[model samples]
Each structure stands twice: as C-alpha cells, then as structure tokens.
Target: MNEIILKFSKESPQVKDTPIEISVIDVQPDYLYKFNAGIDGIWTTIQDFSEENFCIWKPKIDGKYTLMIQGKKKDGKKSFDAAAKADYIIGAVEEDIIQSVNIDRRELLQGEKLSVMVETTVKPVMYKYWISGKDGWELIRDYNSENEFLFTANEPGKHEILVECKTIESKNNFDDFRTISFIVSEIEKVQITDFKCLSTELLTDKELIFQVDARHEDSRMVLYKFVKIDNKGKALCIQDYSSKRMISFTEREPGSYKLLCMAKDMYSTEDFDDRAIIVYDIKPYKPIVIKSFTTDFTSPQTTGTKILLKAMVEGGRNLLYRYMIEGKHGEDSGFIRNNSFLWETKYPGEYKLSLYVKDESYSGDYEECTSLEYLVEEKLFKPVKIRDVALSKDKNYVKNKPINITVSADGGNELRYSFIVYKDKEEVEKINFGIANWVNFTPEQSGEYELEIRVRDKYSHKDYDSHTFIFFNVRDYIPGIIDYILIPSKEYYMVEDDIEIEVITQNAKETLLKYCISINGHPVESTEYSKVKKFKFTPKVSGKYNLEIYSKNIQCKEGYDEKKETKIYIHEALPVTNTKIKSSLVKAKRNEEVTFVVNSEGGKDVCYEFYLMEEENWKLVQRYSKKNYYTFIPFISGTYRLLALSRSFYKKVSYEDYDIFKLEVN
Candidate 1:
C-alpha cells in the first residue's frame, strides 16, 4: 500500500482567522487524492486535487477539527490515508497592555494634593496622561516615559484622571487606558451648643428624649451622632448618624451613663466638633400599688347564697388574682386574669375568705394577700313529726321468722329510729337503730308479743319524740316429711321405654303425709301412700320432661308443703322394621338429581327428612309431609341420609327409619 501522511507547521491550538499550512507526503503521482477537514468531528471534502502536496487552511470559527487526506489510483483502488487534528480557540488579534492604576485617596478637601500612578504587565513603548475638570480633558503629559504624576484640586467638585499606553508589539493601539475619579469639597467648622435629656434620672425600661442644638460656620448640612460612655470611659455608638435633632433611648440596666452628642458638616477636615455630654442616673424598677379592697356583701350572710367577690387593683399593667375560702382554694382561684369572681356559699358557719393579688412584673415579687372572716347563719327549720310507720309483713308472724319494719316521716331531712321487742308486757330486747328505720328480731318462744318503734327528727328535742306499737302472735313452725325426688335414676332414657321415678324424703316419714305426683307437667294421682311410691311412665315423643312431687300433712299449714322437681331426657325411637327408601342408584354424580321414594309395610301419613353429610355430622337439608318422595341435587361429593318418620293421627308416638346414599362430583 502506498501510505499518505499529513504535517502542520504549528501543532498548537490556533486562533480563529489564523492561517495554517498542511503538507501531504508519500503521494502517488497521477492518482486521485482528496483532502478532508472536520469541524466538531464531522469530516467534509475541503479540496480534491490530483498532485497537490500542500494546502492552506484558515478556520473562521473556533473549535476542534480533524483533517484527513486519502489517495487512490484512477481505477478506484485504495493507496494511502493520513489524518491530523487540532483545537482552535478564539483570541484577540493584539494583546491587552493596560493592567491597573492606583491613587493616594478618593476624597480630599479643596487645595489638597492628589497623586496618581499607572501600572502594566507588558512593557509599553509610549505613555500619555490627561486631566478632566470644569473644561474638557486637557493633555498634561504626552509620550512620557514616567507613569506617575501629581496634581492639586483647587475647585470643589469631581475630577477624572486618565492614562493611555501602548505595548512594544503594537504601537498604533491606543485602546488600553486606565481612568479614576476623586471628589473635593470646601471645609466647614461646627459646634454643639446643648445636649440635654428631658430628665436626668430614669427608672429601668423608661424612655428619655435627648435634644441636640448646634451652630455651623458654613451653611452646609449638619449630622448628629450620639455616643454612650460607660463607668469605665469606653464610648459606644448609640445612634451613628441622624438628621433629626432629638432621639429617644430606653435604659434597661441600673447604672450611671454619660451621653455625648457630636455635630459635623458634610465635608470637614475634623470629623466631629466639641461634643456636649449629659449624665444620667438609672435606678432599679419598683412597682407601685394601692391596697384598697372590698366585697359585694357584708358579714353574717345567709346560708346557700351566691356572693360576688372583687378586688380593685391600681398601678399595674398585668395583675393576677387568686381567691380561697376557709383555707380551701376556690374553683375560680388559680391565676385569674380578671379581678372579680362569684362565690357560692356551701354550709352554715363562719369561714375565712381570702384574696391574693399579684403583678406579673419582677417575677411577682410584689404580691399582696389579705383575708377576712364572714359568718353564714343557718335558716330556721319547721318541727318534724312521724307521719306513719309500716311493716313489710303482717304483724302476726312465726316465732322464728324475721320481719322488716320501715317508717315514713314529714318535715325533716334526717330521722332516727328505735326498735323494741316485748313479750308478756316485759321488755325482751331493745335496739338503738340510729339512722336506720328497720330491724329484724326472732322470738325464742311462742307467746304474745309486741313490737314498738320510736322515731325522731335529727333536729328534734327529746320532748318531740313519737312512738307506735303493734301486737303480734308468734306461732310454732313445723317441718315437712319429704324434701325432694330424683327421676329416671340415670342420665337419659329412650322413648317408649318404661321409666321408674324414685321418691325421696327427708326422714322417711311416709305415714304422716299425703303425696301427690305429676309427670310431664300433668297431675297423675294423689293419695296418702307408702314410701316407695311405685309408678311407671313412658314418653311418646323424643324430648325433655319435668317431674314434680309434693308432700303435705293435714295438721300442718298450707305453705308447709315440700315439693321437688327433676329433669329427664327421652331419646327418639327407631321406625318400623319394614320402612325403607327406593333409589335408582346407590352412588350417583353430584350434579345429577336423585329421587327417593318411601316404601313401607303400610301407606300412611309420613314426614320425610333429608340429611347431608357435613364434617362428620348429619345436617338436615329439608323436610316434607305432603309428598311421598323427595328429589335433590347434591352440590358436593359426599354421603347423605334420608329419614322416614311416620305417626298415627290419633297417637303422639312417631317412628323413624333412615337410609344412606353416596354421590361423586367432577
């Protein structure tokens, strides 16, 4: 292969519009050659020549570009290829010479000298200086080698200084120059005539106004500055510059302070005039209070009344009021923002009512608490009397039974009772019942007895007591012969089965009493009988039953009869032997409907119950009485049973029979 290569005179990055020379080596003669240049990595044909070895390229825009050259024979065969790349950055055609300038001061009084100097990084071939004042810029130095100059400002205004230079590389370039400005004004003299506050003595957090009076030689604007001098003679600026004549300041610390006021013109060699000082004395704050307090009502107030309580406080911005009654804080007492409150009286007595007042200043150190005693007299109550007294039971009671006694009274809030029991006109027992109205007593022996109840109001005197009495007969109590009975003698029983219920007695005293028997809640028989009481009962239907037995003697009272109850269970009996169901298939698909017909020895009124198998238990699905057959579709694959129950129209006993069927579902 014939190889082609490209070379450049300068490999460094070139500025825009700068020319670069490129040469192509090892070129094949009389063969087609192409030179390509890329802008931002894209290659394009720049020139296509047959035998050229060198080319000039000047980039107009600044960027990185790739240059490529390729050569081939006229028959379209590859011969040589070369490439070169460089970056081009934008730059000025000439270098910048002016760096910076320096001046002694920017502000000066009239007739003051000003010094200015110029500096440059590159050596300049020429230098020029000028000054701009009331007239246009006047040439002060032309083509001078020295870069520094001095001038005086006689007029009061702004003046501009300019310096122009040229580098040795480009002498015709005058674009590089440095300019600076300064201000000059006439001097003025001022003095402070008076500096005094409204009051020299002040309390903490109190404001004082300080007025300044000054005179100026020139009719220029004057400024006032206030400085505070501590006990150590250190000055601190309170107000820097204020055009106003008076200023207000508040002292927050207890100390002695010296306030100095200075007056000066807008432009002066001396910064401030003779300052006038004022001494101030600040003292710690002490709150003032007036202790005049009063209430809406006087002493000896009636019980159960509402009274208004108030405190008139003066000379405090934030005041707190608290109230108490008889050493107990009232409900409206803690930190009250208001001064007045309502007090509801509770009991009839003398009470100490107190009021505590405080100001929210200085951590509530200044507080005033005062107390006064008041009397609450009791209201007169009417005399009370016993209206009626009653008993829970009849006055004639058994000898050993307890009786409840209660009383009704009028015109009193509280009452007392005294219960006394007497026998044969002699006191047996006396009970001080206190505030209770009822008492229970048991007479030891059967005899004539009397019960007396005395009642009195809580506020009644001994002469106001009332008494009442009732005569009662105590009778002897007799015991029963039989206590209870237990039936079936087992946990459960079956229907149509003969069950013997045993009768049990307290002492086996059968000859002294008459016995009555009831089974299934119906009376069976009653007689003066033996102890065994032999009887047989057969339940017709499957269910639960209750058996009751009562024993009584003719000589005993009517309520002295003893009774007992027993619960029994009777299970269902199997149906007749010949009862069955006729089905087409013993096992069928779950989605298919199966029919069952009842087949029995004799056709009669029968109810059919269908049960499905669910979780090891049989669940009744449906029951029908008017139809002899049942049809159902099983949703789940399982075993099922059908119960055929028959009962005669005149008898309560029912007979049942069941058959199982299996099913499968896909």
Candidate 2:
C-alpha cells in the first residue's frame, strides 16, 4: 500500500477566473487517479490520470472549487482520497482587437526615418514592434504601453512593419497584431559627365587614354568602372573598382571600339550612371614611299621573254600593290597583294611599268607610286648565205664509194641544211641536217648524179640559199659491204615481248638487194632490203634463238653475196610484289612526310621510277637507279596518288604499282 497527497497552486488566496495548476504526490508507481474541481460538493470528473501528477485548470464561474483526487494502488488492495479548496473571482474578459495601423511615410529614401503606430480597442499590457525584410522578421521594441515606433530605413525595397499587442488579463487569448508595408529607395543618384577619349583616331601600336567626370549629390565618394566594348556589344575588358578618373590602354591592332564609363556611389551599388564614347579609325602606320622601282632584265630585252618588276617599300602593313603598264598604244593595269610583278612582252615596243603601294589598313588613302620605262626589241629574220659547198671526195663518182658534202652558212643562231641526190632527174635520196653542216652518201648506182645542198636560218621560213653540183662520169668497181645490227634497241628482250630489228649497210645508200632471214631455223621470207631496214618480231616463248640474214647481189654484182648471224635470248618478266607505306594512314595531313617503298621478285638490280598523277597524266617525279624507297612531303591538300614502276636493268618493260593518299589542310 502507498499513501497519496494532494496540492493546490493557490491554497488560501483569491484569484480571478484565471488558469491554475493542481498536482498529486507520493502515490504508487502504477496507480490510477481521478481529479475534480467545481463549486458543488458533487464530484464531477475533470481528469483521469494513470501516471501524470499535475494539471492546469481554468475556472469559468466564481466559486470555491473543491480539488479532490481518488486513486487505487497497483496491488488493488487499498484505496485513498484527498481534497483542497480554492477561490476564483469572475471578471470581464478583455477583447484584444486592432482598431487601426498607420505609417507616417509610405516611401522614403534610405537613412531616412519612418514612424509607425498601432491602436487597439482594449488596453494592452505590452506592445512589440517588428520589421520584416529580405532577412526575415526582427524585433525592434518590446516593452509595456508603447504604441508607436520610429526607426531609420537602412535597406531598399519593400519592408513590413508588424506590431503585436498583448493583454495578460485575457487568459490564453489576449494578443492583437497588425502589419503595414513601406518602401525604402536608394538615397544617392550618381551622374557621369565629360566622357571623352584624348584622341579618337589613333595609330596602331599606340596608347589611348580616356577620362570621365563623376559626382553624387549626397556628397559620397564616387567609384568608377571602365569597360572597353567592341562593335559587337561584347565587352573586351573590364577595369573594376577604379579610383582614378582616367584610364590608359594600348592596342597593337587597329579596329573600332567604344569606352564605357560607369559611376556609382561608394556606399550604395543600387544607383549608378553610365556613358559611352565612340573611338574611331584606329589605323596602321603611315605608308612609306616607293624607294625604287626596277626590272630584273636590262632595257631592250628580246620579245617573248619575262621581265620581273619589283618595288621596295620601307614601312607599311597590309599593303595593296598596283602595277600599270603604259605602252605606246594602250595601257594595262592590275592590282596584286604582293610587291613583285611579272610582265611578258608580246610586241616590240617601249613601255612604262608603274608600281603603286597603298596601306590597306587606312582604306587606301595613303599611297606611294613610281614608274620606270624600258624597251623590247624584235627578233630579226636574216637570210642564211652559203659561202661555198664542197665534196669530201672528187666530183667524179664510183659505185659503192662514200662521199661527204659540206656547206658553210652565215646567219641566225641556228642553221639547217638539206641534201638531195638525183640520178638522171629522178630524186632518189634526201637527208635533213639539224644544227649540222655535213651529210654522207654512197653512190651505189653509177649514173649522171646531180647533188643539191640548201641552207636556211632556223628563225626564217623563206630566207634560204642553195648550191648545186654535177657529177659527169660514173664507173663501177669491185664492191665491198659491211653490216651492223641492233636488236630490241638495247640487245635485251622478254618472252611475249615485241622485238625490233634494224640493219645498216656502211657503203651502200641506194643499192637494192635480196635477203632471207631466219629465227631458230624458221625461215622469214623478206624479198627486198634497203640501206637501213627495220622490222618487228614477237617471240611466243622463252628460249635462245639464232637470227640469220643472207644477202645476194651486193651493189648489183653478179655473184657477190654475204651472210650474217646473231643470237638473242628472251626471258620471262618479273612482277611487282608489293607497294607499302611507312606511315600509319594512307591519308595524311598537309606538310606531313610520307615514305613509299616498292618490292619486286625475280629481277636482278631493279630500277624504280616514281610518278605523280597530274591532270590525267603521270609526271615522272624521280628515278632511282638502285634504291627501293622514296620520301615525299605534300605542301597542299588534295587527292594524290604515288606510282611506283619497277623495271629490270636491261629491259624497257616495267611493272607498275600505285597507292592513293589524301591530305586535309583545313
């Protein structure tokens, strides 16, 4: 069993109809209790508590309330009871209602004072004032009987002024609050003036200075920020927190720009002023005069030759060069972005070449020009004069006898000679000499022979001279002949390859003879033979073959005949095995070096030739005698192919190998 005790907050004092607290102590840990408070002795349950010992009670009517508690112990074996009495006086409730809220100014500048007041219907025991802004609500004043508040507006924008009234007489409901809105604007206004650059038009690589005047009416220190803006409204640079009124900057390039000056008070950033000044014609340095104009060749140059005109300049950036050619008939002019000009003379005349250089950075306003005169001479058409024509041997001719005719000419850079031999007015043989003065011929047929020699200057078509000689008596003697042969042009051939055979007789020019040719005992039927004979033969298989030639009736003799024999060998051609590149990619970047290698099998000492494909033709790039690889560096971007030709040392036939590569520069 446990004992219970009861307690009252106001044991013997009289209080108004306010809230009071009652408690029970020294009870069992797990006991149940019932509490009652009323004027009547009849117990009306107010609370049933199992573990709590205290409670708050508000009396509605004036009465001597009986505070009682009844409880049982945890064992349910014993019961207990306790009682106390308290007096409460009923009074009139206070109605806490706000009548009005007012402010002296709705809008004011920062650092200015604002007055706020609040009025309530019932008298409040205390008043609280709060100011709410971006930083949230803050209590300004909390005191008894204070209905008004005054404070400085420190921050800008809308602010809330809240006032709370409280009366302790109204138990649990005695607070009245109201809020009013006001605005605080910035106090200082800054003005920017005298915004100017010292020089709007400046030369390149020169400094530019800008100045501005700024002030504020509130007598606060002014701050400045300068920005250089380009024509596209993009800020090139910004100088922040500048204390000085002037700024200096240098630009190496020339362009259009603007200087923006912004001024603000040091105390506030909310108010500021800005002004812009346009700067123009930032130009390059002045153009230098053309010091000299000269040509590569001397005056009186021959027609159809190129002459180079060069102009020397001292100082100018991005210069535009203009060249003018003033001839006797008309004038030709053009512009180039370089300093050199090439001129080719088409006609013989005197002309003036003028060079004008202007600075493109200044819109071609500054220029320097100079001119020079020169002449072009025409090529002369001089006829070739033949001093004499003579024969190596005497004019009387014999059969199978060799004779040489020589001519002397005076004219032109180059002279051409032609020889014609006629037997009884029928022209039999003609020979042309290029840059040579003599020709050799053998009189095979004995007759009255007329030989004519003609000479001409290479530059003239109709200016020529000739001489004629007549041989009166002709006779026949014992004839002797010599034979020379050339096979495959270099004495080498391949299987299935076309072979050309040429035969030359040393002492006979016009004697016709009958001949029989054979290859490996296979008879080749050819009836006639000339002084120099050529024929083609294609070998079908690979082997060694003996070629034989037999000629009869030498120099029209009755029983004079000769026989000759030669041997030729033909072999199979080797194929190009592979073409490789050392680089990782066949496509490369411009200006990159690439290496190409070629390989061949079954060839002794291969010769390699590299070619570049240009405009549908393969141009020979280089030839390697005994090497197999080549290195190439491309300067431009385009599609390119490398052709590698592998050929043997003695054969004209080659095996072609190629690979394609691409370059990208941009």
Give the count of colliding residue pairs in each prediction: 1, 0
Off by over 4 Å in 2: 1-188, 199-206, 215-219, 250-254, 269-271, 277-281, 284-315, 318-353, 358-666
Query: How well is each residue in 1-666 modelled by candidate 1, as lDDT tens digits?
Result: 445666787764566677887777655666666677766336677678566777777777643355666676676644544333333232333555667778899998765678887877777446777666554455677766777788776667887777777764553535466678889877645778777777544777777788988877554677888898877788998887656668777877777989988887654445675578898877564444534344444454555556666675654557878777772323446767778777776677777877777766537533777777876666454334455667767743666777777776554567777888888889989988487767777777888787777766676655234555666777564344554454555655767888876665544552244445445444555655344455467767666566655554444545435655566766564333465677766687867888877655533354555666644677666664546577777677665655555432223554445455544433
Q: What is the lDDT of candidate 1?
A: 0.64
Looking at model 1, residue 481 earns an lDDT score of: 51
Instruction: Please state the error at residue 194 of candidate 1 in Å.
Output: 4.4
Give a tens-digit lDDT track for model 2, residues 11-96.
Answer: 43344556677777565566677676645334566777466677777766543344556776555664553333332323332444
Please report the candidate that would top TM-score against the real structure.
Answer: 2
Query: 661 in model 2: Cα distance from truth in Å?
Result: 54
Q: What lDDT would each prediction earn against the true structure?
A: 0.64, 0.64
Candidate 1 minimal-lDDT segment of 10 residues:
84-93
